[model samples]
Target chain A: MKNRNIPKKLQDNLITIGIVVVCYILVMILSATGLLSNLLQGLLVPLCAYIILAVSLNLTVGILGELSLGHAGFMCVGAFTSAFFSKCMENTITFAPVRFFLALLIGGLCAALIGFLIGMPVLRLKGDYLAIVTLAFGEIIKNIMNVLFIGRDSHGFHFSMKDSLSLGLEEGGDVIINGAQGITGTPKDSNFTIGVILIVLTLLIVLNLINSRDGRAIMSIRDNLIASESIGIHITKYKLMAFTISAALAGIAGVLYSHNLNSLMATPKNFGYNMSIMILVFVVLGGIGNIRGSVIAAVILTLLPELLRGLNDYRMLIYSIVLIVMMLYNWAPNMIALRKKAANRFGRKKEVA
Target chain B: MALLEVKNLSISFGGLRAVDDFNVSIEKGQLYGLIGPNGAGKTTVFNLLTGVYQPDEGFIHLDGEDITRLKTIEINQAGIARTFQNIRLFKELSVLDNVKVGLHNKYHYSTVEGLLRLPRYFQMEKKMDERAMELLKVFDLDGEADYLASNLPYGKQRKLEIARALATDPKLLLLDEPAAGMNPNETKELMETIRFVRDHFDMTILLIEHDMKLVAGICEELTVLNFGKILTQGKTSDVLHDPEVITAYLGE
Candidate 1:
């Protein structure tokens, strides 16, 4: 009976897609064993991260039309929470088989809780005020992680550069998080399988939410707040919903991030407001309301700096030029102006002939 | 029982007293008009009642409970829906989606339910779609449901605005200038739609209309404001003829 019904559920999206995904996995496995490309290996993890961050952040900035410069705070929260849980439970006999899933859930819930708390008071403040407040909150989080001393080890607080390096925070002493070095020894459990599965699941959940009635209401509020209220929509409710969901997705990204890194940072000074803004940049460059644009923007932005390495001493200069060119193209009023000019020139030649 | 009652209501925008001790009582299933020259505080009164601004001096009652200081959304939830003087549809969304947004209040599903598209969610969504369709059909807009609100011609946009307002199932509908840019024939149809909705929903309407012909045709009762005060009010026939209302509001 189960076999008979397998084909029914296996229609187009659910089962057939799984087969394709498995086939792709097999190919990736074979390639990794043979002559794999460093470009491919280096691009994989970051591409996964960008896919999550860009799409999740789009829910806030595009769907809700609220500018936020602190998304990485939520991601950090999820990462730390999940990393801590898994580390503490690593050797526990009871916490086996589903340890990783449980950590991810805890991390997501923690991030979501923080999101709900922050969204309540801050979303009322509009535009720059909201941006500044969220940015400040992110900074505060980074500082707290830096200064909060957990315990003293045999040498001192066990928070030394060498220990940190051993945990993979840095290659040398300049890891930037000295006393409050990044958490380490977080089990590196994320692979292409888990990462790809997560990205697909997030896509399904987010796509469904955006197409549903609540998504429409949030978009309505984003378009016109006064009109939405007049139509009896509880504006804050939907805003909070978007905030919480976006935070949870960021949390999931964090979980994947910490697991892949093995060593975690209890306090991530680098993953602060600047990181959030970078994510926002991807969303805007991609086009706010288009999810496809967001994902593509994430991938391009993640790989662009790496690809620009061949620029040598002038890599940043060349990179900035490329960015400027892309932005100019983005804002150009007539995308087909060059085509039109060429056509006009060719027409004059034909007329003369 | 009165549908709406405002007792000694007043609003002060710091130094400016926008609405000063305004009072009005409207009955259920009645068509009422609030008329004034530009800046007579007519729209201010609507804003105050709708909780855009809380009146400093009086109490407002909808049905029986005093709703003088409720939030805009709460007031709307209490069965008061309104349209803007400037058209404010969700411009990017389609007409049906805009109306469906208004139908959000009737829906009772969690965000998870919405995201997961549970069977129950689909059932509720189907019901909402049917209701939104019915509302559009009533306004002869079922055909244009998929068209973006901003793309609609001026008259059809006005109709869509009202259709969206009705989707909320309001007991009292406030329409602030429902006929600003409509042509004569479109205006005639809008006038019929207004009356039809009034009768169909047994609605209590408070409209801030500039069209005298529209006010005279449909309104059984009217209140005219001049200099932030009600100049004259009675049956539309009586108020239109009032010297103060005509000179101060209805123009020369």
Candidate 2:
């Protein structure tokens, strides 16, 4: 009853944050007590990255009601840009935290810029068309990154689409990005703590925006475009705003991703259509427009494969089954009714107590 | 001056003239009705007035300013708000948020301020909530303010749409078939609500409806359209009794 004093929205946001904090605390305690396996420990930062990606993508797919299949492209933009910056500033900055923080900003801003430019014409297209276009853009970004080359020496930085040798540099020139090979020796400034902090920040921005005036406008457009227009909600502006912010947050995830790896590469397995679909799976299985659901789903789905590694040959088979079950649980009509019934009964019990 | 003035407004789709040379002048605080048979371009006229469809020719003047060239959002900002023939509530949003969306322009805060939870965001949101609740109370929907808009009963959804439109503080309001699917009892209540809205808000209303009972009960003036042309315009009782209007509605 005391909880009634807080707004329902604020209370929901608090519970989501609370779930994250509780999980973080549990993980910390286990790691400190030597109960956590190294393999699980290694998954922590990446888990944070996926959570951020899922939440950010939800901003577009769930809340904004746009299907985008090019999320990995934004992530690639963030990863490469931040990786490039960190490598160049490694010797000069001499401070890991400050350098990493700046890289995060650079990564997010670059992704946002790309998102804005792409959203300008692309947002005009709705439904399946937008999805296809975004999918193509994702591949284009990954391919472009594959053939990109940059080298730095005394005379600024040299760039080329060809091999590293084409980047005509003077003596002692360092190749930061060497086409296909990608960037290496980037300072590993990302950690579990940073990842958790970024997740919290992402949640804060997204949840607050959803509860704000702008969020209402965006949601209105999603619910009914023509009605939203008649009510005077600027369609293009809100669409682009949500798209850009979603892209920027994805970029932050990318920064975390690249920094976690010893070497960053734009490969088909990593920053391609597959990666984009994987993030989308997280969003869908989580429940579209359900923010906390995205976090939980991302965690479970990401950990499932790793947890089932001992199952080996049957691993994927079980994974797909889990995917199907989760889909039904979240979206199937019968399951929805059952869930409602169960919730009602549970509420009655609580009241009786 | 008329609150809404339309002069020779027209539009065509492909080969068909959906609405041709439509003309109407509604004085301040008057309850006006636009009635027509199916495919008579009644809703199309509503669209033109609300900027859902740009007139092929002619002008629309609201209060003294021309708004014919304005975009949909601009038209709303110029103080015209409308509800759709189909209940187009934001189904996923709560009833309160649906109205809050209507109050969006009246309340202002930058995206940055909202994201950062600045004091201005809090102040503006508080003001919006109070205003939205007051609007909801007018329709007796305050009790279900937190329910999803789609969860409301059919009659209540129609009322919610009207309440949402009013949140814009519009000089003119347009309702398209507000009683289309309602039972007679609901229509009777709707007529009372429409009359109350006019008297309480001192508002000008232009509604497109097929419900003759609701129309005759609340509307002060009536315009009947047939084949994209105005068949007649006069006081509610006279228009309903006019032979030409009767023929247009019932066929010769």
Best by DockQ: 2
True contacts kept of 1: 0.75
What is the Cα-based lDDT of residue A244 in candidate 1? 88
Chain B TM-score by candidate, in order shown: 0.97, 0.98
Worst 10-residue lDDT window for candidate 1 chain B reads: B243-252
Per-residue accuracy of model 1 over A1-353 as CA lDDT, tens digit each: 01111123224235423643664487488776975567766557656766788889999888888887888888888877787777666767244438889988998999999999999998776667667877877777766665543323333322433334443332222232333656667666666677777777776777667767888888998999999988888888889998889989988888878777745554443367667767877887888766667777777777766777675566446545655666666667674586567778988898899
lDDT of the candidates, in the order given: 0.78, 0.92
Instruction: Please identify model 2 stretches exceeding 4 Å from their true place.
Output: A1-6, A311-353
Candidate 1, position B205, lDDT: 91
Taking the tens digit of each residue's C-alpha lDDT, what string does model 1 give over B1-252?
A: 798988888878889888887888899988999988888898899899899988889999999878889999989888899988899999878787888898988877877887777887878888988998999999888888777778778888888888888888888999998988777787788899999999888888999888888989999999888777778878999888888776785367
Clashing pairs in 2: none
Cα TM-score of candidate 2? 0.96
